[model samples]
Target: MIYRMLAINIDGTLLQSNGKLHKSTKEAIDYVQQKGIYVTLVTSRSFPSAKKLAKALKIDTKLITHRGAYIANEIGRPTHSSRIKEHITYDLVRLLEGFPCQIRLVHEQFSLANKYKLNHKLLSKTVFTTGDPIVYSQQFVDSIGDTIADEPAHPLSIEVYFEYKEDLKDVQEAIGKMYHEVECIALNDLRLDIVPTGVSKLTGLLYLAERLGIKRNQIVCIGDEMDDIEMIQACGLGVAMGNAPFEVKRAADWITRSQNLHGVAYVVKEHFRKQPQIEFLQKLNIIK
Candidate 1:
């Protein structure tokens, strides 16, 4: 089938190891755009963080962010936002009481705990692909204190990250028992994202689809992680990168090459090329 729109995840899928968009990938996107296909990016990163990437791709379509809790256009304007209920946030804060881990409260960017110590290395590593860690750190310090606090007035989203998966699961289970109002998703072995219920990449994509007057089956989703699973499965076509987790691969409709190996470009070419053949066959009334 020829899809009218394509939604691709940024990290771990479209970006290379050096955190740069491959020249081939950019060209492929331009090629598809010239052919009249719409390309959009769906990511967990905040608007500020996603801006530069959106600019690079010349995307003016809506962006899915905060793990689907928020959806906005290329200009960082919000189309929709889902916040965890006040009571749920209160419960979550209590649930994390005394837990030995780092928690980031995400509004648009990351807000760390007031007393939180700087893990300079980890911070640098995390933002290395996105932006300057030192600059981000300064912003965090300037906005919210070093230690994260439970401010009912704020009513923001939260991401709990642990150094170990075992601990993260334990915390996940602990919070899961108390509140059915939130969603807990593991992005990787090291990160767990907790957001309001019904908030996911799928939700964000659906919102965009509605705005664009496109049906679910007319969209293609691509990603390389478990968090992308919902979106990939929901789309008419789901593409998993070779480096994606086993579960993600299994959930996808098709598997592509590894991210570092031009996997995105390869799959895009395949999809675009098939369109012409289908059109040609339709013209001949062959199998129509």
Candidate 2:
């Protein structure tokens, strides 16, 4: 099928396990954009963190970040934001107080977390997508619920990270039964991302598709995590990285090489090369 837009996840999809974007991945992205296909970074990372990678790749398109809670263009201006209601955010924070997990509230401009969690390794890992410090500000608080109540805004999502999957599972179940307005996504064994009920990479992309005037069927999405499952299921051409979990791979239409092997390059080169535009260039003795 002909595709007009490409949405790619950053972690484990574009960026390698070591948290670096490979040269091959950059070249592949450049080729796709040159072919006139809109390529966007769809990631679970904060906007600033994701923006850094997009800039590195020379991708000027808007990014779908925070697991689709926020959608913004290359300029870092949000086009759409789906946030948990203020009361719901407060309620979740309250419920989470009984647990030992680190709580962080993600906003468009900055992030606020419990001051006590600043040095926690799991929380630190959850804070920044890369080793480089983010341009955005990070504030620590005594109580996330108090912080949100005092300074109410559209928080992108609330991340609760635990020391083990069992803790995360318990919290997920509690949130599931307690609230119908929010959804709990176990990003891994230790982190659970709580966002609005319907928010996912697919919903975020749909909003972007509307803004770009592209049809849903014209979009191709690639990702590697459980948070990516919905978009993989919805996109016209869904690709899973070789390193992706079994379930994510099962949901994909195709599975490419692993991140370390430059899977993104493999997918883009294999698929976009077959497009009429690229084929014409090949037939004309231009690009090999």
Candidate 3:
């Protein structure tokens, strides 16, 4: 089948676990673009962070970021943004503050966050995919809820990070019980991106695809997290990394090599091929 668009997740699908983009992966993305396929970076990362990576990849297509709450291009102008209502943002921040996890209210222009001291090992996870503080306006305050009350900020999403695995689990369960308007997505064990109820990577991609006049069956999605399962199931081709968890792999149409193993490169090379026109084949008397 012919695919026109490739929507790939960043953390575990494109970039390696070590947070580096491989040379092979870059070449593969370039090769795919030459084939006239639109490659979109669909990720839970902040738009600024994702834009920085997009620049490195030389991706000009608009990006899906903040777990699909914000869709923007490399220039940082969003064509779409689903911000949590100010009241809801305040309530969610209030609830998240009860836990030990750090909370950052993510927006297209800036991020408002609470300062939580975490172990050195867990600190990298917070900074790596979220954004560089210097590049992005990441303002740390005493209380995010207070900031919300004072400024009435409407954020695209709320990012939470935990030092302990159990805190992540507990917050997931707590949010599940308390809020009906927000979705708590676990990008991995240490992080969660909570967005407005209807916002998700799949929904965001579908919106973009519709705007571009691309059909659902003409898209290829590759991801490695629970939040990724919907798009993986909905797309024409769904790919899971070899390093992906068992559940994510099970939902995919095919499994590629792990991120560290140049999985994106392998998938593009193996699947993208020249399609023979039926009329041309018939004219050559190859088949009926």
Candidate 4:
């Protein structure tokens, strides 16, 4: 059937291997928009990061960011948020104090421990950037400090990045057992994310659906990572990219080709083309 909205993940799902959107993907999205189906981006990146992609797509739709801890519009206006409790935040900071791995705190953005150190460089590369580490790190820390100290309210979300895959799992398990109120998800082999319980891409999509007056059965979600698990399963048509892990593929209702091959475009076109036929048959109660 014709879906009312489409929720697509950013990193591996939309952008190509080089972190650029393929021409075919953009054209397919344009085609769907012209058909009056709302397209929204669901991602783990912060609003600032996700903004660039949204702008590139010419999307005026809502964004789910910080792994679904925060939801905002294209212009970065908060529509909903779920934050780690203050006590839990302090505990997390304490837990990371002596870890061997690099620690970066994310509050709408990322901040490394040292402004002018190798840690910052490592983090930027791991997170998809080649900018000056000193400048970026200082700016990030300053932003976080200001938010924590001056803002009347605490940040709505926080994320800590680890360098190694093994370290990430250890930290995830430790945090999971320590704090019963938080949710920890390992994004990939190299990254781990923690958010408040019940806050996820699915939660963000539901919030958006409520605002748009659309039902769950009228949505389609596509992704290729662990964070996308909940969203894909919840959507009426849950799709996993061909490059997605075995578990992710198993969780999906359908698996499209690899991202490098314009997988997203293929899936969108297939759904868009088939939706009309399904709707027409249903209208006549052909099989129902």
Specify the highest-TM-score model's number.
2
Error of 1 at 135 (Å): 8.4
Which has the higher lDDT value, candidate number 2 or candidate number 4? 2
- How many backbone clashes does every candidate have? 7, 1, 0, 0
Q: Which stretches of candidate 1 lie over 4 Å from their true place?
A: 74-76, 114-156, 163-167, 188-190, 274-288
Model 2, 127-222: lDDT tens per residue? 455213557777777887777778774577887777656778898998899999888887677878888888888888889888877787788888
lDDT of 3 by residue, 1-288 (tens): 668789999988899988899999999998888777889999877788888889899998899988888898844568888888888788778877887778888777678778787664856544545675656787888887777777898888888887877888888898889889888878778888788899988999999999987788889998987889999999999999888899999999999999989999999888875644434544788533
RMSD of each: 4.5, 4.3, 4.1, 4.7
What is the lDDT, from 0 to 100, of the residue 36 in candidate 2?
A: 77
List candidate 3 stretches off by more than 4 Å: 74-76, 119-128, 162-178, 186-192, 276-288
The Cα error of candidate 3 at residue 286, in Å, is 18
Q: Model 2 off-target regions past 4 Å?
A: 74-76, 117-132, 163-170, 278-288
C-alpha local distance difference test of each model: 0.71, 0.81, 0.83, 0.72
**TM-score for every candidate vs. truth?**
0.81, 0.86, 0.85, 0.79
